[model samples]
Target: MATIYESKTTEIKPFTYRTLLITPDENSEFSIKHSRQQPKHTKKVVLLNLVGRTSTDDIDSYESLEQANLFPLAHHIDNDKQEYEQYSKGLVQHFLFLIELQRLWKSEYDELIDLPRSSRGKFSFRKSDKDTHQYREAQIKALLEPIDPSQAIARTTATEYIGVVVKFYSFQIRNGYKFNKTPFEYEVVSIQYQGDSTSIGAYLGKDVHIKDLRLNLGKSRGNEGGALSSSHKNLNPITNREWQAVRNIPTNTSQVIKNVAG
Candidate 1:
């Protein structure tokens, strides 16, 4: 008899934040609807930042502010239930990404991952030898690099995730939840949208300047001919054989259709 060997694969679970749906008490001031007859119960999405915490019940005051900053957007009057829920979920994912980057930094440098709290108890990241905007940005990019090329995050998704984190920091700054040294450095640049000549901003001679992150992720200068370089270096059009195979798929057969769909 021959001995048989079995290969075991371990699955890595992604980090996630906790959310609670709670109905306010009768005396509570929380109310989304202003109708004469309010519903018996109204639910609210509470996003808790449990980045490195061991217990969900161990949230502090500073963490409360971090969680509360997302409440306005999560329960915005303009957004419906589904829309608000999505926003909450996206915010949680973005925060988790930052937490992952922080873990990478801590493992590499053997130092505290998060910004230090000030004497007044406000979040602040004062410039230091170990902590600087450039150093942090480099660490973030390094962590974001894909270990397996096939499992890489899409450029658009990466951009959106970072944008959400930047916006969250901006909101915290505006609400006095954080002081000096934001998570990322940003610049205001006027963006001209193509094929929007009749837009109000264009007509009114107003340049719409938005906060742009300075992480320098996918930046490229034009070539000598002044043409912008292509970012999709590995992308290629399908060959005739590939196209024919796709076109000749036997969808009428149940097994074939199932295989194609999968």
Candidate 2:
């Protein structure tokens, strides 16, 4: 349990890991109220560096960590083969997903009951199949729930992209949903949408998995995936989910501080 200190005039709240990911129920769903994934009076998320897994275990509490903004990311992909297999095979895209991370304000943690997990940027709750009803309904709601920039309680020291590669080589969007009105079979890479938002050494790390989609390790969609570590293959014994990336691999330390400046 976190210790709460009550003062006279103002509530002097002691900070904890739990404080960052908490959000309300109304803001949980994909609503038209917010244009971007800004903290709209509900969610307050801080990009974490998993102490045992990715980040260095030096500070014990969140307060100590706030004092020392620097956190360590593990360099699991040291070998050229590992890097080639991961990057060339498109496993790099898996590690680095879309920008919109889920705020646990309106949800529960699946694995870590206490700690919250961040959602990938691309996956959306607003799944549409050319339905007119959905579009009409969204427009009606938009009037009442315009994406109010004022409502977006952007934390002064907050981050946008949670699925950041410990160290990234490319920031430019290599792929897109449609190129000259033609759609590609593979996923188009969506890098930092807002210019100069996410930096290299800014975020903390977390374990993530593709919930619905199972993409090939290779970039182009051929047989690009390679052998998993002896321990990580067939993690569940029922399905062929390669749990090695999150389970075994270590995130590399990123020396980069500046992101794509617009």
Candidate 3:
């Protein structure tokens, strides 16, 4: 019999991993509302950069201070605790996904290109580097078209993540965070509606022109559940027979009810 050889593969982990850390914010109004005498404690989500040297302490240091502002923006979006946490989680996931993509792109570029390790620092390309640019574009396209369907993130989830990131950037811009070049592009799209349409846009003479921000990632696939989709299952009133059946069900206090009635 021929000898069989088994090869072992080593997993490559990134040097720096960005993660979300939920901490208590004493400045939050909700915390103050709950406690009159003691200091208030509210949920404050921070994005921490692991395995990296920075001027500030790990607790205060983040991948981006603007990204850390997501917690306050999330509260403004919704005051509810659960909603705030969900929004924070989505935003964190978006940032982490981008970081992973950057790491992978750089790794691939380094392997293909004949350059000094020091020169291949960033995962960006100049206009003259046509081949490098094409490679990056191809990588982005591949991300949209998943090779393994089962491993891919759900369309709805991807949409939520992108939306959260967009909202965070918008918030930063509104607060006077100037970017040398805007991260995304925008185009004015005119939407036409019928005169008899129930939409609010119908009142604006059927032609509604709005500036739609075009994100780097392509449009999300699949339908996001709407009010109508949620309400598809119509509920009907229970009959008297069904109500009596529910009342007749045995309980620990059945004898107590009978004695009280008697």
Candidate 4:
């Protein structure tokens, strides 16, 4: 396959490949508005080339490959299908190994667990629905009995959208919740009102699913003493129970490095 090196000053990330495809007349679409435009060749390349199945020679023979049918290359469509499948299996194994290593480190260091404990500021808890007032009232009472009398914990109620799932530490929301009982260094802060999309990648190469974590100060709809203010009119409805984004925190990669090093 033909290789081209891009200048380092450009905004694109570096890419490595095993095979490449070059398509002519790329500017045809753009040229429709301006006939004098020149057509450029469109180039495609496969990264982390799989040996035998993917190579410099395979670029020319792709139209004949069955796997090429899946990718729309100019050569053979079935010739290297088996090799492609094997490559996929190996990729999954590698991803799982990385995830397991992350789990081991978190267990030993409790990296994510210490953030909330370190925050000395006051915060209220909230719920996702308001339909069951009696149940929520009792729940709030039970949660507050053990806190230091001077430290007041309020309940603010809110509602979650249909099909929205939250990940939170249940024990953390309950009185007598101790830091040591949490998983690895992770604790159940609350099953409260944060919104999360399906996890796209947390395990094998195939976008394995896992719990998505979020942090915020606001409460959801069903908590006691809730309010609707003019300021919240345009916030995302899915996470309306709380402000969609956390503001006022300084974010930097150095903190992640510290969490890892700790």
Candidate 5:
């Protein structure tokens, strides 16, 4: 369902996070051993509370409305480009999962909404819009298999949740025990982004603490000599196996897609 926008003085709650799933202990060995492990599948579930307005008119029309409303509105009234795009993409994918689940368990679940028509052109839910649907379908297909309606429908459900936890740890081994300058050698199991200069969490392994990943918010690590050197950024050090698993993904999307898709 589209997000509801209320007119009263609204006190929006903070976004909540959750651990969807934990892979098998053996699969998690990549992080525990601080080296690349065999290519193994894994998954995790994350819950994000999206607070935004959705119009009955259609999501596509909002772009035009923004043009007409141009400058007079407060900055907060504007949609956060990154956040909104991310949320919508995620919501669409999750909604697709719900549809698939409903198909599988018709008696237990009902679809929240019918697919909306595209505002820009005549696009049906089928292959009419191949470019858009391809990505959305791929994302949804991955999710349907992993999502367990047995748990809460969404992460916010009060009961226990296990189906959402992510599994899969695949990275390559370079020089084995060495920590630096290894090709494709990073195993970022998890990340926490606050949208600030600091405190970008990257859990590489059970051991090996990297200070830059946990800097204080609004602070610059470069001033404190925590800036990663050119070499550090260049060395992916992943094994052929793990690299293949994440090969199709672009570097910039690696963390967010991995975390959110789970």
Candidate 6:
């Protein structure tokens, strides 16, 4: 069901931040060994919240995701320019564990318009959007399956997240690490889903150095920094694997695909 949006005095748009997800060891001290992705420092993190519980109806909900996208899903390896043509496929894609942003926006696309009054975008939600977003992340178990590929290069692909026009912001890796490069944040502005590029596109004008955003958000660590909001208040951030609620997902993760279709 649609979430009722009663215009609030404080309009909060989602903001991206770089964070690390680290788990504590038996000693109760943060250790690199206690992680999923097992980054040398910490795993990348993102902000996600449960939508609700899932039931059999989620299958239909998954099928319904296509209607939300402006793109069709796939394109030839070779396609022409017009540069603007990339977004034709539609927004939603072959997502096993994907779902709409329970807390992200719709009007974010209007940022280019420069309206006098600022407001949060109207997010697209399925009638079952709430029920769908829930527990579905369990599919990450499927998403994390070991790919046969030995080495991987992390890069942004256009076919992913088509309907959002993002404003880029830059930040560097936390202090020092094995690798060092600035990561940029993409703020969704409009839903004119377009072609993908490693770069952010030249809409800002000529001479703009377009950089492809290849990054992921990570879970937050306590003592590492920041306090949790009231919701996660009692939850101990230092506890090992505290963030991981669903453990030991099936090797055959069809459940995830069947569940989190969007």
Total clashing pairs for each candidate: 0, 12, 0, 27, 26, 29
Against the correct fold, how does model 5 do in TM-score?
0.17
Q: Give the Å error, residue 2, model 3.
A: 41
Candidate 3 residue runs with Cα over 4 Å from true position = 1-66, 70-82, 105-144, 186-262
The Cα local distance difference test for each model comes to 0.42, 0.25, 0.41, 0.28, 0.29, 0.27
Global CA lDDT of candidate 5, please?
Answer: 0.29
| Predicted candidate 4 versus true structure: per-residue lDDT over 1-262, tens digit per residue | 3322111111112221234334446665432233333332223222222122234434222122222122312111222221232232322222233334334444576555644222111221323212122223333443456245444333322112100112112223232334422211223232333334664544323222232222223444441322323234344554443343222123433221111111
lDDT for model 6 comes to 0.27
Question: 170 in model 1: Cα distance from truth in Å?
Answer: 3.0
lDDT of 1: 0.42
Compose the digit string of candidate 2's lDDT tens values, residues 1-262. 2222111111112211211333356657543233333322212112222121213423333222221111111122121111122222122222222111122233444555654332322222333411122222333333235476333322210111111221121121232222221111223333433334565555444433222111112222222123332332232452344443334444553332222111
The most accurate candidate by lDDT is 1
Which is the leading candidate under TM-score? 1
Error of 5 at 176 (Å): 49
Poorly placed runs, candidate 2 (over 4 Å) = 1-101, 105-172, 175-262
Pull out the clashing pairs in model 1: none
Off by over 4 Å in 4: 1-82, 110-262
TM-score of each: 0.44, 0.15, 0.39, 0.16, 0.17, 0.18
The TM-score measured for candidate 6 stands at 0.18
Stretches of candidate 1 above 4 Å error? 1-46, 51-75, 78-81, 84-90, 97-144, 148-151, 173-178, 182-207, 214-239, 250-262
CA shift of 37, model 1, Å: 11
Flag the better candidate by lDDT, 4 or 6. 4
In candidate 4, position 71 carries an lDDT of: 33
